[model samples]
Target: MPKHKEYTILLLSRVTLKAHEFITKVVQSNSAFGPCPEYICKCGNIQSDICETATVAISSVYHQVFKTKTKFSGLEVLGFDKTIITDELLSDLPFRPYNFQLGILRIWIVKIGCSNEITTNLAGPGFKSAFIYQYNKSRALFFQEIDKNHCRVTIYYECNAYIDFIEQNPDLVWSKIGILQKYNRNQLFELTNQYTTNLIQAAQIPYCTLNEWNNKEIITNIYNYHLKCCIIANINWYQFFCNKFEQPNTIIELRSALQLIYPIEHEIGERKFRAWKAMLKNVGCSDITPYEKDQSNVLNNLIRACMHLWTQRISY
Candidate 1:
C-alpha cells in the first residue's frame, strides 16, 4: 500500500481594519462548524473528522488572535474554507496517469485569511527582490490585491506517492506497449512544436502592457504548456527507446534495455552537428561496438527532433 499525499494552500489577505473586524466576527460565529456531509464524502474522508479538526484549529487560532489586539505585525487572523477534492485541482497536478492502475489523489486544503511571518520578511528590500526572483523561477500562480489593503498569497504543499505499481503488476505491460505505439518521434515533435508556438504567440504582448486578466491567463498557459511539453517528451523518449531496441514486447526486456541506455547524456557545449558526426562514426573502430554505434544514431535523431521544436520562436 502506498501512502496518501496531502496538498495544502495558505492564502493571506490584508483588509481594512473595519473589514478585518467584520471577518473576525463571522469566523467566531462559525467556530464549531464542520464541512457538510457532501463535501466530506466527496473528499473521501472518514465522516468529516479531518475537516472538522482543521476547522476547529483554524477557529481557535482566529479567536486567540482577535481577542486582544486589533493590529498585528504579520498575517495573524486565519480561517479555513473547505477541503476540496475536485477534478479541477486534480487536472492541474503534475502527473496524470494513463493506462496504469496507480491511485493518484490530491486533497486540497485551502486556508483563507491566513497570516504568517512571510509578510514581514517581504518588507525588507533585499528579501523582497529575492522573493520575487524565487517566485518567478517557481512559475507558481500569482495573485494581487483586489483593492488597496486586500491581497492574497497562496502556497502549495504537495506529497508524491512512491509505490511502483508498474513493477508490481504485470497486466499493465500491454498498456505501456499501446502508449509506445500511439505516437512516433516525428508526430510527437510536430504536435509539441505546434502547441508551443500557439502558447508563445498568445503571450507575445509586452509584459508591461498586459492587464491583470491577461497576465493571469498568460501565466497559466505558460505553466500548462510546460507540463504538456514534458509529458510529450517523456512519451516520445519512451517510444524512441522502445523502437531503437527493436520493440521489446515483455516488461522485463524493456526494463533491462532502459536500464542500460535510458538517459542519453548531452554535454553542455555539444553541438547538433557533433551528434550527427558521432552517429555517422565508422563501426570498424575498436572503441565503439555495433550496439554503441546504433545507440548514437538513435541519440542523434532524438536530439535533432527536440532541438528543432525547442528553437522555434514564433512571433505574432
Candidate 2:
C-alpha cells in the first residue's frame, strides 16, 4: 500500500485591527456559539497549532499563483475568485463547496451600498440581499463603496488550508452555514463540514480537531471531485507563482522546477524538449511529454495563463 500521511488544511481570514473591530461589532452578533464542537471537544491543541500567520497585502488568486515560492513543501494551491455579495451576483458566485472570507481586512460582509449600510454575513442565495439588511446606518457608507465600483474586498481563499482551518480552529462560526440551507446549502462549506466529521467517525482523531463538520469522505471527494480542480488550478497556480510572496505549488510545481535539477544536454533540437520532458517524467511528472521546439503549444499555454494571472499580485 502506498504510504499516506494525514493532511490537515487551515483556512484563515486576515484583517487589520481596524477591520477586525468592525466585523466583531457587525457580524459577531450574527452567530451564537453553539455546543462545543466535537472535533475539538477534547482537542487540546489550539488554533496556533497548524494555522500560520496571515500574510499582508494579497490581491488576486490569479496573482498568488505566480507571485512566490512556498515556504513549506508538500503544499498546493486550490483555486481563486473574488466574492460577490448581492443577491443576483451571489447566485452566480454560490458558496457551496466554496466559502466567503468574511470579517474586515478591506473585505467585509456584503454591503447594502456606500451610503452607510450594514450587510449580513449570510451564505448562499440570500447571502447578498440578506447581508444588506443586516447592516446598520453607521456602516451604510462602506456598502455604497462596494456597490458603486465593485471593488474587490478580500484577497482570496484556497481549498487545502480551508480544511486545515477547521482542524485548528473551532468550526463554530463555520457551522452557521447550515442556516443557508433554505437557499441550497450548495455552498462549499458543506463538503468542508463533511471532511472534518469523517476523521472523527474513523476514531483516528488527531491531537486537535476542528469543530466543523468532519469530512469523513475527504479522500473520495478530493480524488473524485477536488482533484480535477487541483490538476488545473494547481498547475495554473504554479505557472503564475511569484518569486516574492511565495513559490507555486510545491507539490506539482516540483515537476517543473525539478527539470532544472536534472542534466539536460540531449540534442538541442526537436528532441531537446522531448529529452528534458522525458527526464521530468522520470522524476514523477507522468503528465508531461515532449513538444516541438519552435512553438510548443502546451508550454506556451501554461506560460500565457501564468502571466495573465500573475499581473495582479501585490509586489513587496
Candidate 3:
C-alpha cells in the first residue's frame, strides 16, 4: 500500500489485489460550471434549462477539519440534487463486510439549477446534492443515508445504466452531474438498446440471436450513424420504425409491427396488455408511467454503477 494522502483515496472494486493505495490532495474548495450551450436537454415532459452547477466541500473527520479547496468541486457535485447532501453520516457510515471506506469525511453545500448563467429559487428545478470523498482519493460518492446532514437518496437505476455503458466501452467514459435529466427516459433506454443492437456487428455476443434483423449489411453500415443520431436527433421509437420499415406510419402500425418481434400475449396477459396499450393511446408512449422503473430493477444498480464511474474519473 502506498502512503495515505489527504483529499483522495483509491476506490478499489474487490480486485484480487493483496493491498490498497490511498493518496490525497489539499482539500476544500468551491467553483461554478455549466453544461455546454450546444447541448440541449430534452426529456419528453421537462425540457431542462441549461444547468449551471456550484460545489463546496469542507474536508475533515466530522468536525475536526483541514483541507478546503481540494474538496470544493467534490462537494459541489453532490449539491446538484437535494438527494445527495453530506454531513456526519458519511464518516460514520456502516460498511459491508467486504467493503472498506477511507476518508477524513466532509460536508457539502451544493446549489443546483437549470442554467449555468441563470439563477432561480425553484427546487426540483435543481438541488443541493451531497457527496463524500474517500480519505486519499478524488473519487467522491453520494452520501448514503444516515441523518439529515447526510441524506443520500439512492438513484441506483441510472447509475447501473452508466456502468453497463462504460464496462462495454471501457477505454473512455464521460459524465456530467445530473445530466441524465437532460435526456428523455425512453430515449436513454432506446439508446442503450441501440448500443446493444450495434454490438452485434462487431462481434456477435456468442449465442445471442440477431433475432429479427432482416438485413445484415444495413445493420453493419448504420452502426455509427445509429449511435450519432440517437444523441443528436429529436427522434423517438416511432420515427425509428418509420425510417427503417418504410412500413405504415400510425401508432397502430408501429405497435403491430413491433409486436411481431416481441408479441403481446393475447390470452394470458389481456388485462396487462390492455393497460399497457391504453396508457400509450391515452397519454402517448413517451408519457408512459416510469417505463424504466417498470422495465427492470437493475436500473437502480445501473445508477449506482454510474456514480462509481463518476467518482473514479474525478477522484484522482
lDDT scores in order: 0.26, 0.24, 0.27
By descending lDDT, how would the candidates be arranged?
Answer: 3, 1, 2
Across 1-316, the per-residue lDDT of candidate 3 in tens digits comes to 1133222212211111114211122222224553221111221232222223221112221112322334334223233233433432142222211221223323342432222111111112222333343322334354222122211233233333211112111011113223334443222222123332242232221111122223444433433333332332332323442343343222233244334544256332444344334323222122213354335211112222333443332221
- Lowest lDDT 10-residue stretch of candidate 3: 165-174
Instruction: Put down candidate 2 lDDT per residue, 130-226, tens digits, no spaces.
Output: 1211122222211111222122111112322111111211133224322222332212222123432342233221111111113334322323332
Rank the models by TM-score, top first.
2, 3, 1
Per-candidate clashes, comma-separated: 1, 56, 47
In terms of lDDT, which candidate is strongest? Answer: 3
Task: For residues 1-316, write the lDDT of model 1, one tens digit per residue.
Answer: 1134231212222234433332211111123464221111111121221233333433443445456433332223332332342342242232232221112211121211112223221111111000111122342221111112322223222222111112111123213323223433222112123432343343232222112223445434433433233332433332322344342221122223333433455321224323223222211001122244225422223222322333232221
The 10-residue segment of model 1 with minimum total lDDT is 124-133
Clashes of 1: 1
Task: After the best TM-score superposition of candidate 3, give how far the Cα of residue 308 lies from its true spot, in angstroms.
Answer: 8.1
User: What TM-score would you give candidate 1 relative to the actual structure?
Assistant: 0.16
